[model samples]
Each structure stands twice: as structure tokens, then as C-alpha cells.
Target: MSILSLENVKYSFENTNILNGIDLKISKGDCVSIIGTSGSGKSTLLKLCSDLISPTSGSISFYEKDYNSYEPINLRKQISYCVQIPYLFGDTVYQNLSYPFKIRKQEVNKDKIIKFMKKLNLDESYLEKGINSLSGGEKQRVALIRNLLYKPEILLLDEVTSGLDSQNAKIVQDLIKDLNEDGVTVMWITHSLEQSESIFNKRIQIEQGKIVKEEILK
Candidate 1:
């Protein structure tokens, strides 16, 4: 079944259309990449799916239910959104990882957190280090782990690996591949055609807010 469906979606700001009649479907366990030049409504499309902004016209559905039917917070929890530059909070790495659970009134699982960190090539000792002391790559890894700790049904990534070095970028890419293999639907926006070809099975190209092509790659 399709996890996400966008039917004739349209968006605009002050009457200037940004997205025009976009129709797309993304299935569970699929790694789909949306590629376009900057200002081509790539991020806007992600925001629309996450219900961060309402579409000007048309419908968006998740798991066959209209997006408007779900509670905002509930929808956000089930569909985690990761941005290009991650934002980290709290004094230490451990505190940042535990923040999501803490806000949800749940106990933090240290072992699980550590395991996720290891998957991203982060050592357990880094947990006690202050967030301010880490580099951009470290912050991004920690932010990503925090998002995945609860295992959201779908992850919306917006140029998530753009800020990483080659080594760290490989780690993030591998983690994304692992998540898709484990049945998490991923809708990612990227400018790198090479990365798109390597990491995603489906590609949707957008130009001037319209879908110009949708290709399924082996």
C-alpha cells in the first residue's frame, strides 16, 4: 500500500504558485528522492507532506487517510522531518538524545541510544561531551539518532547529508539505506544526482514546481 499520496497538489504564496498539480505516490520501504535545483519547491513539497504548511489546493493522504484528519502533533511524531542543518539542544550529547523521549513522558533507554550512536560511528564516550564541543558532522549524527530512536513510520529528509564530510556522509548514507531495508519509508530531497542514483530506488524530478519525470531505477 502507498504510505503517502499527493493528488493534484498546488501551493502558492501571495497568489504566486509554487507547486502546480503535483501527483505522486510513495510506498512503504521505498527510498524515493526528489531532485531539483534550488528554489524548485523541493523543501516546500516536504513541508506539505509533513503538514507543516497546507496546500493551496488538492489533497495529501498518509496511510490512506487524509492528512487533515490527523492531529498535528500526532502526525509529526509518526513522520519525522530532518533538515539539512541539524539543531541540537541540551548541554551534553546524552541530554540531546534523551530530549524527545523526555518531552513525550517516556523513560530514556540508554542501551538503545548507545547502539544507534554506534551505528553512526559515534563512540559511547561522546555521550557525556557537551554539544557545543562537537563538529557539524557529530551534531548531525546525534540529531539523526534522536529522530530514529522512536522509529517513526516515515522519515522526511531535506539535504540531510549536505553538510557532512566524505566519511561522515558515507555513514549517513549507509544508515539511510539500513533504515529503508528495515521498512521505513524515506522521502529525501537532494541536489546530488549521484547520491540520488546510489541511495534511492525511485526518482522524481521537479522543475518550476511541476513533476517533469518519475523514474524507477534498479
Candidate 2:
């Protein structure tokens, strides 16, 4: 089934086009990657998909429903975006991890958090530490776990592994691969051509604000 669809979508800023007549259809549980050079509107396309930015023309739909019809908070719960530079709001990791539950007025899932922490190579003791003490890679992993606790059907990632050391990068890469294998849809943006080639089942290449090609790997 089609989980998300963009039809003739276009976006512009100050008369400069970012995306033009872009059409994409994402199937449930399908892994997709978006690739293009910098300034090619790859990030812009993700923002549009996540409803962070509205298009100048055309439409985006989720599950055959118009994007604008759903409430923003409710929609975001199903489509999560994890950025490269993760933002840690509170002072401590526990506070950050509990944020989702706090906002939802629900109980925190400590068991699930611990389980995911292990899978992401984080120790339970780290959760008690302040965010200021964490390294860059640690912050990124925490951010991912925090967002993923809700189990969003579609996970949007932007250069998720860039700039990290081999170990941290490998931990993230393996974790995400397992998530997709377990049936969470993933769409990511990456600069490494080799990473893009190796990870994605289908790659969409954009150039000059247009989808130039779609490549499916073996």
C-alpha cells in the first residue's frame, strides 16, 4: 500500500525554485533514500514530506488523505524526522527521553528505552548523566532513541551518520538497517555515494530541483 505520495509538488523561496513538479510515491515498509548534490533541494524535499514546509504548488498526501487535513501534532507522531545535528533540549538524558511521554501525558516506557539503548550501544547509566557530558555521537544516538520510542511508521533521516567515528557510525547504520528489516519505513539523505549505494533499496536522485532518476538496486 502507498503510505505517502507527492504529486506535482513544487516549492520556491524568494522566487528561487527548490523543487519543481516532483512526484513520489512511498510504499509501506519500503526503504528509500534521496540523493543529490548540495543545494539540490534534498533537505527541502524531506521537510515537505514531514510537513515542516508547505509546497508552493501541487499536493502531498498521506495514506490517500490530503496533507493539510490532519492535525500537525497527530501527523508528526506517525512521520518522524531525525536530523544530523540532534537537538537535546533538557539538561539530562532522562529528561530528554521522557519528553515524548511528557508531551503526550502518558507514562514513560523505561523498559523499551533500556532495550533500545542497548541496541544503540548506550548504557543504562548514561541515561542519568547530563547532556553536556555526552559526546556528539552520544547526543545523536539519544536523539534517535527519543524520537523512535513512539515508533513512527516512516522515519526521515538527514545525513544521520555523517561526521561520526567508525564505531558510532556503524552502531547507527546497523540499528537503522535492523529497524527497516523489522518493517519501519526509512528515507534518508546522505552525501556519501557509497553509503547511498549500499544502504537504500531504491534511490531517488534529484538535480536542479527535479527528480532526474530513480534507481532500484539488486
**How much does candidate 2 score in TM-score?**
0.95
Query: Could you tell me which 10 consecutive residues in candidate 1 have the lowest summed lDDT?
Result: 81-90
TM-score of each: 0.94, 0.95
Off by over 4 Å in 2: none
Candidate 1 Cα misplacement greater than 4 A, ranges? none
Local error of candidate 1 at residue 185 (angstroms): 0.6
Error of 2 at 179 (Å): 1.5
**Cα misplacement distance, residue 217 of candidate 2 (Å):** 1.0
Q: For each candidate, what is the lDDT?
A: 0.90, 0.89
The global Cα lDDT (0 to 1) of model 2 is 0.89
Q: Tell me model 1's lDDT, rounded to 2 decimals.
A: 0.90
Q: What would the per-residue lDDT of candidate 1 be over residues 1-218, giving only the tens digit for each residue?
A: 88999999999999899999999999988899889988889999999988899999999999999999999999999999887788887699999998888989989889999999988889899999999999887888888998999888999999888878888888889989988899899999988888999878899999999999999987
